[model samples]
Target: MERPRYESPVERAIREAQERGEFDNLPGAGKPLDLGDTSDPMWWVRRLAEREQLDFTGALPPAVALRKEAATFPESLTALRTEESVRAVLEDYNLRVRRDRLRPPDPRMPQLLAPTVDVENLLARWRELRAAAGPPLAEPSAPEPRRRRRWFRRR
Candidate 1:
């Protein structure tokens, strides 16, 4: 014979609420749960990322993150207004890549390697993009200095 389970006060309150229809018509009611195909061990992590609007790349290994950044480097450079800024960005990226390469490889991800990028090639591509986009629009001239009205004649 099995003993009846005792319900705590909190549980009793919740059960009473359910019986009173208070729990009905809640969000996602009657909808099938979206527990994705369970093949992936990290499915929960992915789900949490999606739900929280996280950047999945941030969770990647350093080498993988560097590779992803390299792949998207050109597109990212489109926002920079100066060749100097572009150069700085590329140099920083290269420095990080070199640093990552020097670190002892992680046994779990030994094959993940991020190679240094060609700064000259990326700069050339940036120049081409800037030229194709045409010169940046000139900044609007400072509004004529607003003149303050004199409350009284200076005589």
Candidate 2:
């Protein structure tokens, strides 16, 4: 005798039901696994694990949990971008300042006031001299103011 095809109780029942058109024309007629609405936590976990190359069989790592939090955390993307841009600008400014300080000053302007080594002493001496100096004696004006008119007047 030829061996009959073996079918599990559940499988046989499902096949018989389908033949009877009991499950025909379902709302979700035919759809691929990855394309359907998946609210199950396992599906999400599996996708996450696949994308991150993580083992879904184990508990989520601290870093992964943090990333998930950060991804959905309530914060504006514009604000974050602006903050990053500002930080970069500040870093560039500091770098430029350092580079400028490393460069030599203009040799053409030798007379330019440079930082003084004895600033305190120079300022003190200058103040003392200025204080001791007498008011400039106004050049004694001529005993008589020179008159614009001469003894002979213009005709």
Model number with the top lDDT: 1
What is the per-residue lDDT of model 1 for residues 1-155, given as tens digits with 9 covering 90 to 100? 34249978887888789879998999999999999968999899889988999887777899989988999977789988888999999999999988887888777765678888899999999989888998886766887888777878554
User: What's the TM for model 2?
Assistant: 0.21
- Look at candidate 1 and give me any clashing residue pairs: none
Regions of model 2 farther than 4 Å from truth: 1-8, 30-60, 63-155
Instruction: Report lDDT (Cα) of residue 89, candidate 2.
Output: 39
The TM-scores of all predictions, comma-separated, are 0.74, 0.21
In model 1, what is the error at residue 81, expressed in angstroms? 1.0
Model 2: per-residue Cα lDDT over 1-155, one tens digit each: 34249978988888789779999887767964563347775777667767799854246433333344334322212222233443453344445444544566566633222121232443344445444564434555568766687657854
Query: How big is the positional error of residue 82 in model 1, measured in Å on the Cα after superposition?
Result: 0.9
Off by more than 4 A, model 1:
1-7, 139-155
TM-score of 1: 0.74
RMSD of each: 5.1, 32.2
